[model samples]
Each structure stands twice: as structure tokens, then as C-alpha cells.
Target: MFSDRFDQLVQALRILPSVGPKSAQRMALHMIMKNREGAIGLAQALTEATDHIHECTICHSLTEDDVCHICSSHERDDELLCVVESPADVMAIEQSGSFRGKYHVLGGHLSPLDGIGPEEIGIPYLIQRLSQGKVKEVILATNATVEGQATAHYLVEASKHLPLHITRIAQGVPQGGELEYVDSHTLSQAVHNRMRMK
Candidate 1:
């Protein structure tokens, strides 16, 4: 129905997550017809970001420099290291304002079925970093999924020799969640990890 260039633009837009053919077509039309300047700016920004952004050498988080701002900041506690699965997780933790510790992004969790293992997610490097004795505590903040739990357990086993105090992030019902709506696994975890309040 449209020109080759328009179809190409729609296809390009469809590359974004959750965007289908119709949505991509709508986006393409909106960009070309209503938001040409905004579209151009978006294109330039995407190009610049892709060119500049890279993994931080220290923690494997996304950054424009060798080390991310969080890893380089002296204000954060060096003794507390939070291990996460991705840069997005790091962003989530930062937004929560609950933690003031260093981070280690594993890039991904263990998935043996997908051939992802310890080496693939830089587990060895994490152990090496922990072995240096700078971090007194290591918080396993990976997702609560099976893969994430396995990765956390593997890290615990690997670092058993070290004198570090390792802990997993609590998993359970959300702040506004009701018991009836929660899943069995989550409810079980909530019960098992119940805190004693005096």
C-alpha cells in the first residue's frame, strides 16, 4: 500500500520489542507525516548512543567510559557488592534508592538449555573480584526465576572458600499484592523467608 521506503521504515520500527506490523506502520506514518524533526533527532540520538555506549570494564554495566559512574563513585560502599543480571536491573535498583553499594552485572543468568553457563556470564571474573577481599558482603540480586536462583547458588558454592558474607535478595509478594492473587511458589517463598517482628 505504501512505497518501498515506507515499508522499510515500518520494518525497522518493528524491530523494537512488543511492536507489531500494524503498530510499526502507525509509528512510521507518524514519524514521516507528523514528527519529522523528532524522528530525525531520534535517529541521530540512536546512532550516537550505539556508537558511544559500551560495557563498563569493572562491573559489565553499560557506560560510555571504561567504568560506569556507580563503579567509579567513592561515595558508594565498597564493602557491599550487589550482583545483578543486567544493566536494566542496575537501573531498577538505583531508582529504588534503597541500596548504596557497588554493583556487578552478570550480563545474564545461567541457562544450561540455552548453553549459557558460568563462563558465559562472567562468574569466574566475579569470584576473582570477590577473592580480593575488598568486598565484605556480596548480595545476589538476580531474578527469582530458576535460572537466576541457580546462578546465585552457583556463586555461593564457588565463593564458599572466601570469607565474604553472601546473601540472596528476598523473594515474595509485592508491596501491594494480595495473598489470594499470589502464586504458590511466591507464597511459599514468602512463608519460608518470613521475618520475625518484635
Candidate 2:
């Protein structure tokens, strides 16, 4: 219904997650008609980012350098390592302003059905890093999904022989969530993890 370039742009925009054909078409039209300058900047930024950004050699987080800022920061606790599923998780944790340690990104969780295993996610390499004896404690910050739990369990089993202390992040209801609206499993977990006020 549009020019070849316009159709191609719409198609490309549709490749973004959760973007439908109509939304993609709207975005293409808006960019071309109202935001051509911003669109050019966006295109240039995407090109530059794709050309320079890469996985950090130490933590596997996205960085323009060989090692990410988090990994290279001497102020961060090297003895306390937080293991996460992805760079996005790392970003979330960083924004929380709570944790003050280094991180090890797993790249992904273990999904047997999907053929994602320990080696596929570089779990063995994680174990190797833990075995270096510098890190004393590891906090598992993977998501609370079944696959995430399975991956955490696998890590626990794999590191059983090591002297490092392993801990899973507590799961419970969100801060503003009401009990009636919360799922039974999360409520149960919240009850189970309830703290004493004495």
C-alpha cells in the first residue's frame, strides 16, 4: 500500500518485540513525516552502537570496551558476586541502588526442551570463575520462573564441591501488591519467608 522503502521500513520496525504491523506502519510514517531528523540520529546511533558495543570479556555484559565498567571498578566488592540471566537484569539491579558487588551474567537460563544447557549458557565458565577463590559468596538473582529455578539449582549442584557460599534471591509479593490479588505460590513464599518482628 506504500512505496517500497516505506514498506521495508515498516517491516524492519515490525521486527521489534510486541510491535504489530499497524504500529510499525505508524512508527514509519511518524519518523518519515514528523521526526526525520530524530530518525537520522536514531539510525546513526544504532549503527555506532552495533559497531562498537560488545560483550564484556569478564562479565558478558554489553560494553564498548573489552571489560565493562562494573567489572573494572575496584570499589565494587569482588568477594560478593551476583549471577544474573542477562545484561538487562544487570541494568535493573544497577538501577536499584542496593547491591554493591560485581556480577556474572549467565547469558540465559537452562532450558532442556529448548536445548539450552550449562555449556550453552557458559555455566562451566562461571564455575571456573568461582573456583578462582577470589569470590567468597555468590547471590543468584535469576528470575523466579521454573527455568530460572532449574538453572539456579543446577548452579548449586555444580558448585557444591567449591567452598563458595551460594544464596538465592528471596521471592515474594511485590511492595504494593495486595494479598487477595497475589498468586497463591507467591503468597505462600511470602508467608514462608516472613520475618520475625519480636
lDDT of each: 0.94, 0.95
What are the clashing pairs of model 2? none
Instruction: Report the C-alpha displacement of residue 98, candidate 1, in angstroms.
Output: 0.9
lDDT of 1 at 121: 94
Residues 16-83, model 2: lDDT tens digits = 99999999989999999999999999999999999999999999999999999999999999999999
**What is candidate 1's lDDT per residue for 123-153, written digit by digit as tens?**
9999999989899999999998888899999
Query: Where does candidate 1 stray beyond 4 Å?
Result: none
Clashes of 2: 0
Each model's backbone clash number: 0, 0
Model 1: ten consecutive residues of lowest lDDT: 1-10
